[model samples]
Target: MLMENLLRSKEYWSLIEHGVVTAPANATAEQRQAANESKLCDLKVKNYLFQSIDRAILDTILTRDTSKDIWDALRRKYQGSTKVKRAQLQALRREFEVLEMGESESVNEYFARTLAIANRMTSHGEIVQQITVVEKILRSMTERFNYVVCSIEESNDVTLMSIDELQSSLLLHEQRMKGKQSHSEEQALKVSNG
Candidate 1:
């Protein structure tokens, strides 16, 4: 996907999609020039692919004559069968459904863990939306965040709330809780010392 995006950005994706352009012997100078440019772009794309992979993978694809060949080879080698992909997506969905914030986990840690799984699901073709992620986090937070979660849900249109906004609100509440806990500890220490 990244390679496709990169090629698209450079306007070189045609080389991958349409294969190499070959100008016939009767072609005009303009047509020959266009073919030459396409060949050059194809080489550039191949170079990018070569630079991105490790030595082991590069060795396997070294014989590939064109960027499209390399791309197809990598895709075939890495993209599992339909059944494998379906099974992986199913497992990810189950994991996402069961995910919950740990009692000792901070807001950021929980978000990171959830987002990681969400990203994996997306890569596997699951259409995970920001609202879905926000709702999941709100519902899966530890018991201590229950009141805040309720307040957020009651006050905000959760369907429109961004993941960043929800994260910031929860992070602020987490910080305040930590501050109060530390202050309470300090007060206890002062009383015992006295």
Candidate 2:
């Protein structure tokens, strides 16, 4: 061991040139046995898991119906999610179906190409009958959007102040007549004086 250390100290790379590992020739039997035991231990632990480890785990998962756990696992997998994403996707689909949200160009393009349709519907100086139809459609769509966004609890304001009642309360005949006196005697006195 002293001789090997002396050689290693002299020149480190000289041992490699001479094709030799400067192991301790005078090592005790106990030291040699310990080194051998360590080598064996390392060899045994090498590549402990077989290639089938992944297949085994996959097989166990496939055989089981882990629906309850799956829901939990899926929830955990997706961190910080509010509502599930679905409405915008549906809206996009509707847009594609209608071509309004799809292969459409612009308002100018629509007018230029669909002149007869525009003329028939009376769109923007095209047709006269289109106004009522468009108004009715707009009213229907407005009511639908309002119904969707508002809940029953939020609709109490609408039930209170109503237009039908307001219209009924208005005395239209009294407002329309010109110089209609409250008392008929005043009118007769005015006529006699004249």
* RMSD to the hidden true structure, all candidates: 1.6, 30.2
The residue pairs that clash in candidate 1, if any, are none
Residue runs of model 1 more than 4 Å from their true location after superposition: none
Q: What is the lDDT of residue 35 in candidate 2?
A: 56
lDDT of 1 by residue, 1-194 (tens): 77789889998888888878989999999999988988888899999999999999999999999999998889878878888899999999999999999999999999999999999999899999999999999989999999999999999999999999999999999999999999999999999999
* Candidate 2 lDDT by residue in tens digits, 52-86: 23564444434322222322333344322323224
Each model's C-alpha lDDT? 0.93, 0.34
lDDT of 2 at 130: 38
Error of 1 at 145 (Å): 1.1
Best candidate per lDDT, number?
A: 1
Q: For each of the candidates, give the backbone clash count.
A: 0, 1
